[model samples]
Target: MKNVIITGTSRGIGLELVKCFAEAGHQVLALSRNSQPVSDLNLKQVTALSFNLAEATDFETVKAYVNTHWKQVDLLIHNAGALVNKPFSELTPADFQNVYTTNVFGVAELTRVLLPNMVKGSHMVTISSMGGIQGSMKFPGLAAYSSSKGAVITLSELLAEEYKDSGIAFNVLALGAVQTEMLEEAFPGYEAPTTAAGMASYIFNFSLTGSTFYNGKVLQVSSSTP
Candidate 1:
């Protein structure tokens, strides 16, 4: 069983990933700004940590926690992200900074601190949006979010190339529109058939095996695809 750490677990995909990993018999370290309602009274190996993930300081706390207890992480999914949907004209520097702090910088910082203890067979899963690759026409408010995720796509590709022989793998799940709290919050009119829990299951099952076919690869799952 692997030890998995996930941030932004209060709702949506992050919460789903947390439960999926726990069910798969892996030790799950869930960190978020809020609690997940304590669905299971019999909390086994699953742990929930709360933090403002965008803050740069969280990385050391996360790394220190693992170093003290588990000593290593088999998988680190940077699934916690924020969407700033606003017209570019109205987008302020603060808006971009806040989004980047959580979406890119925070994730990168956490990975850097954790990599020293992360071993072979370990994988990193980052959830990027199709907007990261293709700009969204229906939602112009997503400029900040789109640009931030775009950086993630580029970062993963470079990291994969750099660590090609390190026994470490990096991949991005460039998602289409999925039904989640964030989705509705960002785009209220979007119709989604797949929920966060379902997507979480897909991510967990997909990462179980080691496959370079999808490694260094950007896979997009969208509701608009045929």
Candidate 2:
């Protein structure tokens, strides 16, 4: 069984992912600002860690814990993100910084700290959004969120290329609208075609097979065909 580390495990897709991985017999480290929900699951082989991804300093605790317990992580999934839905004209500099701190900087910083624990054949996956990719439907109020996700995709590509010879794979999954609390907040009264559990299952399977068949690629997951 692989040792997996996933961020944003308090609710929605992140919580579902924790369930999927734990059910698959993997040792999972679930990180979230409020880890009580994950802890309440009481699943075997699952450990809950609390930390705010938007705060860079909070990762020191994670680094310390990982360094003490885990020798290596087989799978690392960056699923935590911040969405600030505001028109460009109304968006402030703080809005971009806040979004990027969680969506992009957090991923980079965590990976950097955990690099030593990622051996050959390990995999890193970042969750992006369809809105971040070119030609995807762009909602006017999601500039900060979309731009940060776009940067995440680019960062994954660069890391993939950098680690190509080391046997470590990096990839991004650009997801379509999924039914989650975050989505409801972004688009009130609108229903998404995909559910968190469904997407979580897909992500769990991909984390297992993706490193072997794909590397440095962005795969889009959605129920709606375009």
Candidate 3:
């Protein structure tokens, strides 16, 4: 099948995407900051890698991993993100630096380092947020997180345009709220944010469908309930 690289795969949506793709027989390289403890049961096509996204130089590790293991990557998923909520006054420069380090800087750096090895038909999926689309009552201590996601949307759009003629597809998946540790940690007691596994399947299938004429498109997901 396709060869894929998914960031933040130690947990949440990224993890689910890894399992989904591997189950479907695609070779997947899953990267995360923490060693997520894969069962290591000799699953030939799937792998788990741990590296800190908050550091720019860490990308070299990812680059090396791919260069050493695979010849080409058919898809790249930018899903690692950091979100913390606190008053703007209370948020420190370190907070901004950390959030953007993984959200904007790391995402961009990882993609840039891997782009040369991506073929034209390959696709890139970025998980953004509804907070990036339009501000809502959800602005409780989310300035850094929301702003970083907004930057993700813009970056995906620009890349889409830049690669239009190259046949590379760029898509932004704006999720409403996924019930992940990051979400629960940022906003305590919020029921599950969203289903990571289901969303992963839809995105994978969507890209393969010819509907990709809508490349550079934005797809947003949020909890249907409160």
Candidate 4:
């Protein structure tokens, strides 16, 4: 019954999240660079858009959709992410820029554009990574990706405090390894303890109810250590 917005819905966890919300009978706005996959699903009450988080024009499209269609957004999930797996010495400035653009900057810009449509009690759930956690564990090749994730964690905290009186909640979920295409591309041959559908289900439930107990908090949803 709620109007929900989910980004990165082309494949992996994002794709599963779209299914979870649609099957639950929620009105879903699924955004991704390649929207055809979600378009092919043809789920009732689901609208898939070819959206690029890194592009400012796409945000305008989302604003138009929200203004024209949904009166309010009950939940916004920042599930889109970009990763570059290369040694620090080989990493270029453009590498960091691209990762930050999609992961950090995009999340901020999209939230800004959607803020007016999100009423009191709305929840903004950002999908972060355990690698982003300070003093947890560090990997050599994830300098840009992990740093961008960390930036968002702080950004959510700041937003939660800034918008405390507004009644909107901002929280983060720092996830462990999941068996996703992104994982395969980053760390080949590694088997994860969780699946995309499993994580999606967890996130779906949390988005519905987590605001009651948490705001400006980062829950480390990991069964295994990184």
Model 1 per-residue lDDT tens digits across residues 130-151: 8888544435788889889889
| Candidate 2 steric clashes | 0
Clashing pairs in 3: 86-141, 176-221, 176-222, 178-193, 178-194, 179-193, 179-194
Shift in Å, residue 93, candidate 4: 0.8
Candidate 2 vs candidate 3: the lDDT winner is: 2
Candidate 1 minimal-lDDT segment of 10 residues = 35-44
> What C-alpha lDDT do the candidate models reach, one value each?
0.79, 0.90, 0.79, 0.95
- The sequence of per-residue lDDT tens digits that candidate 2 reaches over residues 1-226 is 9989999999999999999999989999999999999999999999998888766777888778777888788999999989897789999999999999999999999999888889999999999998789878788899999889899999999999988998999999999889999998788877888899999999999999999999999998876621
**lDDT value for candidate 1?**
0.79
Query: TM-score ranking from best to worst?
Result: 4, 2, 1, 3
Off by over 4 Å in 1: 36-42, 134-138, 210-212
- For each candidate, give its TM-score against the true structure: 0.92, 0.97, 0.90, 0.99
Residue 68 of candidate 4: its Cα lDDT? 94
Best by lDDT: 4
**Count of clashing pairs, candidate 4:** 0
* Candidate 2 structure, TM-score to reference: 0.97
Order of quality (lDDT):
4, 2, 1, 3
lDDT of 4: 0.95
Q: Which stretches of candidate 4 lie over 4 Å from their true place?
A: none
